[model samples]
Target chain A: MNAFLNQLPIGLSIGAVLLLVALGLTFTFGQMGVVNMAHGEFLMAGAYTAYMLQSWAGRQAVLVALPVAFFVAGLMGLVLERTLIRRFYGRPLDTLLLTWGVSLILQQVARDLFGAPNVQVKAPTWLVGGAEWSGIRMPYARMFILALAVVCVVAIWFYLARTKQGRRMQAVMQNRELAACSGIATSRVDQRTFFIGSGLAGVAGVGLTLIGPVGPALGTYYIVDAFLVVVAGGLGQLRGAVLAAFVLGLLNSYVEYWSDASLAKVVVFAVIIGFLQIRPQGLFVLRSRKLT
Target chain B: MRRLREAADAVASAAVRWRGPVVFVAVALLLLVAAPAALSPFRLELLAKYLCFAIAALGIGLAWGKGGMLTLGQGVFFGLGGYAMAMHLKLAEAGPGQLPDFMVWSGVETLPAVWEPFRQPWFALLMVVVLPGVTAFLLGLLVFGRRVRGAYFAILTQALAAAFVIWLVGQQGLTGGTNGLTNFTSFFGLDLADENDQRVLYSVVAVVLGLLYLAFRQVVASRFGRLLVAVRDGEDRVRFLGYDPALVKTVAFTLSAISAGIAGALFVPVVGIISPALLGVVPSLEFVFAVAVGGRYTLAGAVLGAVLLNYGKTTFSEHYANGWLYLQGTLFIAVMAYAPKGVIGVAGQVRDFVAARRGRAAPAVVPPARVEEGAAA
Candidate 1:
């Protein structure tokens, strides 16, 4: 019972980070229809952003890094969107290969800049402690991240659902020609959507620092998992991303607990494959007239 | 004089018709004869390894190029083939029902029953072809049958590869852990250590690649090939015309898996290692990388792309290890941006341009879209 209770925070924190990453993917991939294989590199860039800020700002780096990472990564995303990704909007496979190239370059650059070894971010003093009950213990950092993830998920959900810019983004996603005809600036919407999505990835990177090791390939680890989140969640649906991320995270936690870490990953993949086989459109599909 | 002129014309047409097969045979002879005579033992082995990759590339051309399925997880099948062969070799090295060394160290007292079947060469050989074929067929049936196409399919395959690598790394005892199966001594009673046997192995690989290439050419020329292209361009139109796009896709995917599997099985003996690192999403992408660079639509382009890029990678990595990744990355981006059609496609464009410039009217070949138009029509 105690172990199970202890597992909850770990699972929730993992779910939170996944949700944050997947939210970004949902926008860039789900909403915008860009494959963006280099999306994971944004996460790596965000983590490195926090790591750099930490050296200059001390423990308060977490506070300073969050917004800074978001903007920095967001700016990069905007540049990439404007120069390259926009050109290949009609070409997903090419976009996939191109973004992967970007990811490789980013990883190699990170390795050169930060060195090949994994970089650990110093946790804030506030998050150093934990809550203990009987033989079980849950760290404050995980709890903090869980809370942050919830806040971010809610914020994104509200933004996408309520904001005018969000509606424009949604309109473009649904029908780019139709949206443009209706007087929506589709290109502007695309730029903003790409920026916001990448910004969220940066934010997720900041959260990642608290939970795991920060390295050049940090994004690589989560990128596929993030893709799975979108795939399982259903394309272009924020609520689905949230629900699916949590399910996958909890499933990952429980499975890892039952077996070795490597097996857990395999099991997760197997489950996703099985799930995809059963529900090819995912758990929550859009009610479009499109044929399956 | 008229009869002699007529006979000369017949011979000219015959030569033109036989050019493709003649070139193919010449390449095969070059690989089998000229290679060993020209290259050292070390270079021969490297060429063999590249040929294995070429085998995988050929399959990618068939599937991704022809059927329009971007199979990013071929490394899974390749690994499956490698591991199957590696298991047999490990058992052969161990000599009759003995637990492999790693298994013993990991406290596995007995050889796992699952691995026992691979002890036979016939069984292992069958598995190299059958395993990946079955896996691909099932996966294709599910995904393609359900109408999963384009990037969605690519992402799914990539995820499977990532998962597969993780799984292989985790099951260290069964899979020889991260070190993979090494120190292979014999292959089907032939001493692998002998230099002559090594040449034979290279010859066998060359012959297999040649046969695979020939087989792929026949498939590409057949009626099924046009159907595949039709489906790739517009799946819905084909479906409405009463053809099953899913079945066509599944067959192409399965053919690709078999090729990848065969490459993998050959790779173990030639390369002597089959680690999970070699079978990840990156490596799988490398398979696609060869196809993309070669001209995915052309079988010959696939073979050339695999050989040239792999040789480039080998030499580049050997001299300046770190620079290789940068080059590879740059190439990936450049290829996608500038050369979406790849080398062969570029050549076709050039030919068309030259013909037009020379004032010879040529049929305009419609430029293929970066993405398939799909069932939208």
Candidate 2:
């Protein structure tokens, strides 16, 4: 019981990061049918932003760095969409190649700017300690990340479900032509969608700093795992993404404990393949006709 | 006199048609065959590895360019073939009943059961082809059959490759861990270290590459290639015409997997190493880059693309390993933005322009815009 309780926090914390990354990918995949290979790079940029900022201002300002990283990465995402991605809207394969090129460029740029070695982002004093609950010790940082994830999920859900702008965003996602005809500025929506999606990735990167080292290839590491979350959950479904993230996170954590990390990945991939064979549309495929 | 004039015209047209590509291939083959003698063994080995990569690029061109399946996880197939061959060689080196050195170093007590079949070169080669094909067959059935087109397919495949890499790295006992399979001693009982043997292996790779190129040309020129291109243009239309788009895609993807597997099989002997790095997301992207830069839609383009990009990589890394990433990134971006049809596409454009300027009566060559419009429509 103690081991299980201790493990849940770590799983949940990792799930938080996965959720953030997948949530943004859901938008890009769902709306435009584009596989942004550079999605992870967006997350890395955000994480690196925080890392750099933390180095300059010390650990106390980590929370402040999160939003700043979000904006920086988000802005870049908007620019990327306007310049390169917009041209490849209906051509998904070309988009995949183009984004892959962008991803390489981003990674190389990161490598050039900040040497090849792993860089650290120090944890704040308040979040550095541990919490003893149910005879199991849980790290405060992990728990905090979990809370942040939950908050972001709820905030995104509320925004998408309730707000006028959010509804317009959904309208575009559901039916781009219909939404545009109804006076929803689709171009603007695309910009905002990329901004939010990339911002979420940035937030995830900030969240990742708690557990792992940040480097040029940090995003590449999470690229597959996050893509898995998006696919398993059903492309574009935010709620589905969170659920899938939790499942994968828990499965991966348990697999790591029972076997090796690499084996766990193989098992997860096998399971995903099996699951996909069974449910071609995924765990919670969107019901809209447009995607079909 | 009229028959003589007609014969001369026919001969001239045939020569004009075959001149450029024929010369290019002849020159390339001559250079590669001569390279091993002129260059050091290290450079010879590097060229051999580049040929292996070319094998993967050919597969990508078929699967992606012709079939429109944006396969982001080809590394999974590549690794499967690579590791299968690697396991066999390792087992062979370990003798009749011993664990491989990597397993011994990692404290594995016995040989893995899955690896038992690879002891025979025949079995290993078969698995090298079959394993990736079967895996791709299953994956294609699941994704393509369900109509999971575009980005969804790309992401799923990419994720699978990533997962495969992680799995290989984790299985220290079965695989060679993160360092990957290395320290091969022989190929089918011939001493690998001998200069003669090394030269033989290089020649074998060159021959295999030539044969594979010919095979790909035949396949792409056949009715199957037309079907693939049709599917790429309009999956729904093809379906409406009573052709199963999924089955066609699966076949192309499977054949691609077989080619990649063969490449990987040869790579184990020539490259002297096969690791997670070689089969990871990055390498998979590199294969795609090669295809894209060489002209993904053309058969010759795939081979040229892989060879050129890999050669560039070898040169760049040898001189500036630290800065090569930047250089590669610049090259890909420039290629994608300025030359979407790739180098072959650009050459074709130039050829058309020159023909137009000369005011020569020439056969109709389809414009890229028409191809793009047809695809989009």
Candidate 3:
């Protein structure tokens, strides 16, 4: 019973990390319909950003790294969009292959720059401790990640719901032709979407440093899971991503607890494949009138 | 003189008709006779390994290029076939009623039930083709039945590959763990250590690849091939026209999986190992890379691409290990960006350009606009 209670926070924290990594994918893959395989690299870029900042900022580098990493990753995404991805627009599978190439390049670059070993970032002093309540031990780092996820979600909600540019992005996602007809500059919206999407991955990376190992292959480990989250959550639906991420996270946590880690991975994949069998469109379906 | 001219015209038209088969026979002769005679024992074995990859590439060509299913997890099928063959080899090496060496090391008291059936060489060989075929058919039925495709299908397949590798790694007692099944002494009754036996093995692989290539070429030229293209270009339209797109896709996917399995099975003997490392997401993507580089739409191109790209990989890695990933990544991006149809497509363009320059009408070549237009719509 105590073990189960302990697992709740751990599960939520895992879900938080999943949500963070998947948030950017929601924009690029879901909204823009571009399968950016290099989005994981953006997370890597962010983690590396935090690692780099440690020279001057010490343990507190993570807090300052968030906004910086977002921009850095965002800019990298913009360059990828303008240079290579733009040419392959409307072709999701090609983009998948193209971005995979970009991912390979980025991974090699990371390996070359950082060497083949994992570089550890010192957790902020505040994030080192944990709060214990009724046999549930919730580390401050996990709590911080959860808090960050919530804050990012709220900010994103506000941006999409309240801001005009956010609505423009939504309009483009819903119907590109219709949005273009209304002078939305669908290309600009796509750029913005890619930036935010990639930026969110960077933020996710920042949070990940507190919980997981930071290395060149770090992105590859989470890329599939993040993708699965977006896949099960459905495209162009924020609420769906949230629901799916948490569910998958809890499933992952509990399953890993019950069985071994490797088996847990297989089980999660099986569940997703089985789930996808029933709901091909996923947990949420976007209602569109466009015909192909 | 008029009769002689008429006869010459008749011969020219016949040559055009027989071009494909003639070329196939020529390539077969080159692979079977010329390759083994020219290359060293080590190089011949490497060529055999590449041919295994080529067989898998042929399937990718059919499914991805023709049927429009980007199967990113072909390694799963490949691994399935390889492991089946590896199991049988291990069993044979263990001799009658003995557990494989790894099983003993991992404290497995008896041969596991799954390993039991594999002891029979025929069953193992049969499973090399059957397992992947069945797995693909079921997966295709489930995914395609619900109309889940495109990027979703690719991602799902990749995830399956990842899961498969993880499962393989975890089963230490049964699967030989991460080291995988290696150190085979014999195949069938032939000694693996002997050079003559190795050459014989190479001959068998080359022959199999040639036959499979010819078979798949026939498949791609038939009415079903046209239907597959139609389905790829427009699935909804094909469905409205009273053909089940799902069934057609499933068949193509199944065939591809079977070929990948066969490739994997052959890969074990040629390469002497079947590890989780070779059956992961990256390796599966590498299979796709070969297809993309060669020109996915052409059967011959796929084979050529597999051999050439793998050759490039071997040579490049041998000289500069650190730079190979960069080169590979660049090759993918460059091919996708400037040469969407790959090397064959580029060659076609060059031929057309030369014909046009020589003041002759360029041959009627189908534009590779189906994928772009379909996606755009």
TM-score of chain B of 3: 0.94
**Candidates' chain A TM-scores:** 0.95, 0.94, 0.97
Q: Give the alpha-carbon lDDT of every model.
A: 0.86, 0.81, 0.91
Model 1 lDDT per residue over B1-377, tens place:
99999999999999999988898888988998899999988899899999999999999999998878889999999999999999998888888868877788888888888899998989999999999999999989988887877887888899889988888888877887788888888877667778788889999899999999889888888999889888888788899999999999999999999999999999999988899989998899989988888888788888888998999998899998877878989998887887777877887778877999999996688656645442110
lDDT of 3 at B314: 96
DockQ of 2: 0.46
Write one digit per residue (lDDT tens) for candidate 3, span B195-243. 9999999999998998899899889989999999999888988999999
Please say which candidate is ahead in lDDT: 1 or 2.
Answer: 1
Better of 2 and 3 by TM-score: 3
Candidate 3, B252: how far from true, in Å? 0.7
For model 2, give the RMSD to the true fold: 3.2
Residue-level lDDT for A282 in candidate 3:
83
lDDT of 2 by residue, A81-167 (tens): 998888777666676677887888899889888988999889898999898866777788888788878888898889888999788
Candidate 1 vs candidate 3: the lDDT winner is 3
Which docking band does candidate 3 fall into? Answer: medium
DockQ of each: 0.56, 0.46, 0.58
Please give, for residues B1-377, the per-residue lDDT of candidate 2 as tens digits: 99999999999999999986797688566755677778787777788888888888889989887887768788888888888899999998998988889888889887778988888879988899899999999888877787776666777788778778877777777788889999998988667888778778888888877778778878888999999988887677888999998899999999898888888888988877899988888888888889888988887788889999899888889899867877777677777777777888887767767888899865586433112221111
Ranking by DockQ: 3, 1, 2
Model 2 regions lying over 4 Å from their true place: A1-6, B1-8, B16-33, B351-377
